[model samples]
Target: MANWVRISSRSIGNHIRKRMNQGFIGSAVDINKSSGSSSALHGGRTVCDRNRRYLNSLPWNRATLFWFQRFKSTVAEKQQDSFLSSDTDDDQLSLDFPGGKVSYTSDMNFISESSQTRVPCYRVLDDDGELIKDTDFQQVSKEAAVKMYSKMVNLQIMDTIFYEAQRQGRISFYLTSAGEEAINIASAAALTEQDIILPQYREPGVLLWRGFTLQEFADQCFGNKADYGKGRQMPIHYGSKKHNFFTISSPIATQLPQAAGIAYSLKMDNKKACVVSYIGDGGTSEGDFHAGLNFAAVMEAPVIFFCRNNGWAISTNVWEQFRSDGIVVKGRAYGIRSIRVDGNDALAVYTAVSAAREMAVNEQRPILIEALTYRVGHHSTSDDSTKYRQSDEIVYWKNARNPVNRFRNWVQSNGWWSDQQETQLRSSVRKQVIISLIGLDIHNLHFFSDT
Candidate 1:
């Protein structure tokens, strides 16, 4: 029996082979080093330090030391716990060299079933309401942040006032983008006045931010004499020749391909403008969706296909619409760069769209941004979402990720505003909305004959 043992698979196999070769084990074998090293008196000797003054040592002890040194190095090289692996097939023994080089060997048995299969959401703002920024987090200027915040706040206030007017029978109908202010206004903030805005009916925030006055909004809403569409279009289907905002359409996704065409025209003229078109998540299921993405990719057209994924199209939830992941992935299949962002965050939406606009203008590539969000209000004044969507779902969107409230929080957190200031701002907006609504009542205005 040995006092200390060094066991190796190779050593065990060699010992077994040697035992078969010999008839019997020797009673004792005296060891001697080839060099003039120590030989102990007793056949079984205690190992001594090699570096000691006794220069001579036992050959067997020297051999044992050499074997162990090699064995320890080999074991250390292969030692890695497989329990912590993110991938099951990997053995997890990784060599971290001086320069950041890594190597891996696959061992299927070491893989675990508990590995994460889905990507966690990438966002700067955490669920706990903390601001997190990193190099990967897209950064925009503070000036842009404040301006975007102001526009979103204004749009939200306007949406509430106008929707309430519709409920009170003061107006025929109105579309409220209550939870969509960040997606609508921040994306508009990302664009230039020269760029074309192909808006779906719910995105009045774009027009309002681009200097469409309250009076102009009222005129369009009322279909009065001052209306830009000359009372030919219905309320809120506003557009401007000078402002570069395209007229809003009633058909589901008509503006999508129209945006591609407009983008093609911009390329034809070698203009600096890029076209941005907004649509609902449900709109991406339409034929126009495929045509728009394909046409833009083929032409290398400068268009930003913005999808506001507000979780519902009329009474239908997003789960009922498609089974093939989100809308952003669909855009990627078209050979267009696509991004998905927290549409509740104005800063995130603005930064994303601004970068997309830059890529569209500089690289001449069409891009798509699917803004993951929810609409707390009805799909439109004519439809009721409460019929299908859970009341709690609407409440979740209204309280949790409310675009208006998020911007307000960002505003206050940054010392850009106070609660008193916010109250005053809301009060001012309400007063202005009332004035604009009252001014729209005109006895001299003629009615539209067109159906």
Candidate 2:
């Protein structure tokens, strides 16, 4: 016997190939049974002290050490009994290291069931906002639905005004979230304020959901003194420590690795939160994307690599971006759970990310989500999408397949909202945007310029 417990039914066979699952991470549980609490061990040394020394002795950093500390704190008495009695997949092993060999199970199996068949994208709401037949509809409360809708509408208003502002030479740059706003707001609604968000520049809806005001957005975009980054960052490269969102970096796929490190820290402290990193389809080409996901998988960091595959990675379509089927397949390569969601369907995105977050935080593991949607507007204020893509394609998405309209339809059908409410909401948001745009830095309005 190897004195180990291999938890069964994993999509990937054994996250730890030999050592940790055998008796490394699970070692604390063995000691936990004999002497409870933070009491002393056989050498009259405190359990915490011994644990720290033991972890430090291994090839683990302070982050891994902290993960053990936090896990040790939360291990329940029932868990101890289950560990003591269970014989689920205990097996001996053999390993060749730099110095010697250890006894272990030579047989290994990968659960191909997860990836063998075609994994369908999860969808709860249709374009008409009607629930699909047999949809285990993840119900959003009236209050939550309203809040999410408000945020989505807010994103729309901000995008329209900001895009116009850029055209009018009021600002140097702007990026409209457009069709992806539902994905942004709904996902944020599913998460707590404490969960760190590493977003692309287009995900201002997440910030708004976390109480990042329109005025703050204005200040940042204008590079005014009131901006939190002190005018150092470019427009839309917003960050708010108070909101728990990392500053948006322009470099593709950089945030994914940073998110991995952040999640590892959270695990070390045993916080009930996960990091969600957003990236575009083209970003998958970056080496950091692979490095970040692979590192998170191996280290068992609690993070979510959210791929906002809006059909294009700034003019390069998804077909040209990757050879694989989609971003979800990449998760299987990384040896973790993943999902493909209907990015235009707010309910679907919310459900998928919520479940992913639960698994990430509770299991201290990583999950990837590939959101299948389209970028309905220009890549930014600089690039003209019309030059590369067809006008009909644009009309199809913006008119017939608008996510905000789809969600609004669902809300109306459920009696959560009405035509009057929708009208009033739109009117209010437009007025509010106008007010915020005009009221911002009124005394120093001249300070804003294309320069």
Cα lDDT tens digits, model 1, 1-451, are: 5455434467544543243223122222223345423334445553222332332333343335333211111111222223222343343555555533355666546644233442233355643335775625456566776677777777776777777777777779888888888888888887899999998887888888899888788888888888888888887898998889888878989898899988977875579989999999989889998999998886778899998988888877788999756787787567788888888877778788888999898778789898888888887789888788788988987887777777667666777768787777766666666678764333422221110
Which parts of model 2 are misplaced by more than 4 Å?
1-118, 440-451
Residue pairs in candidate 2 whose N, alpha carbon or C atoms collide under 3 angstroms: 67-268, 92-104, 92-105, 93-103, 93-104, 93-105, 94-104
Q: lDDT of each prediction vs. the true structure?
A: 0.72, 0.79
Off by over 4 Å in 1: 1-122, 127-129, 133-135, 138-142, 440-451
Report the Cα lDDT for candidate 1: 0.72
Give each model a TM-score. 0.70, 0.75
Decoy 1 TM-score against native = 0.70
Top candidate on lDDT is 2
Whole-model lDDT, model 2: 0.79
Residue pairs in collision within model 1: 37-56, 37-57, 38-56, 38-57, 88-111
TM-score of model 2 vs. true structure: 0.75
Model 2 lDDT per residue over 1-451, tens place: 2233434535322333222323334433344445432322223334333332322122223433333333331222244345334243433344544434444544786655344565688999888989999997567899999989988988997888878888889889999999998889999998998899999787899999999988899889899989999989999999999999899989888898899988987886569999999998899889999999998886788899999889988888888877677888888787768999999999999999889888888878899999999999899999999988999999999989999999998888888888888788877676666557657534443433321
